[model samples]
Target: MMRLELNLLIEGLHDFEKAKRLGSLSNEYCRESATIYLSQEDSSILGVSDGDIVEVSSKHGSVKVRARVRSDVRRGLAFMPPSPYSMALLGLDEHPSIIKVTVSKSSGEPTSLTTLFTS
Candidate 1:
């Protein structure tokens, strides 16, 4: 796979900070329903388990992350934490309204057991 990097130019950091201070971005950490389907299927795939290190990538970028398989057996589906690590690849063009995410398997990349918060 070809290595790719993304450059994001966030305009007016100070203005965003001020807006956040005024509670404009107060719910930045809120969690919402997210679903990932491995492919267009219904029966579901097995073998992978929760806490497993997986790589999610897109044409724009890629990142290694943990997987949290749901118990309901939604074939070809997976879930992950909603954090900066996951949100970094998302496009914020429709701020406060929409978030478009393009993701795929980060195959061929190395996987580790360490968490991002670990020192």
Candidate 2:
């Protein structure tokens, strides 16, 4: 059931050709890299440091990524480098977004890297 819902969500996002066109592609269909920013308050709360691993989760799903803590400060805010991995967990739309991520102290399993690529 969850897989079905996820597929539908992905399909809906893929319907927006213009948005997809705006996305940068490295292999014609995949995004290579993106810039992500974080707020100071969130960084403090999560205790995220440069090269720290952050596990972001939402009602729909969850993802883990390497975090690069920034100097800028804003409470309850964070960002993720745009890629298929982030997109899968974050969904495609900007407004009425699907997911809210959380930064944490726990180190996620190393095997999790495969999921990032598979997305």
Q: Using lDDT as the measure, which candidate wins? A: 2
**Count of clashes, each model:** 2, 2
Candidate 2 C-alpha lDDT tens digits along 8-113: 1122233233345655443333321222244555555666666655555555456655555566534555554345555656544543333455445447532243
Relative to the true structure, candidate 2 has a C-alpha RMSD (angstroms) of 9.3
Give Cα distance to truth, residue 109, candidate 1, Å: 10
Model 2: residues with Cα > 4 Å off, grouped in runs: 1-36, 91-99, 108-113, 117-119
Find the candidate with the highest TM-score and give its number. Answer: 2
When summed lDDT is taken over every stretch of 10 residues in candidate 2, the lowest stretch is: 1-10
**Per-residue lDDT for 18-52 in model 1, tens only?**
44455422433221111132322321232334433
How accurate locally, in lDDT, is each candidate?
A: 0.35, 0.45
Model 1, residue 41: C-alpha shift (Å): 8.8
What TM-score would each prediction reach against the true structure?
A: 0.37, 0.53
Residue pairs clashing, model 2: 40-73, 40-74
Error of 1 at 118 (Å): 17
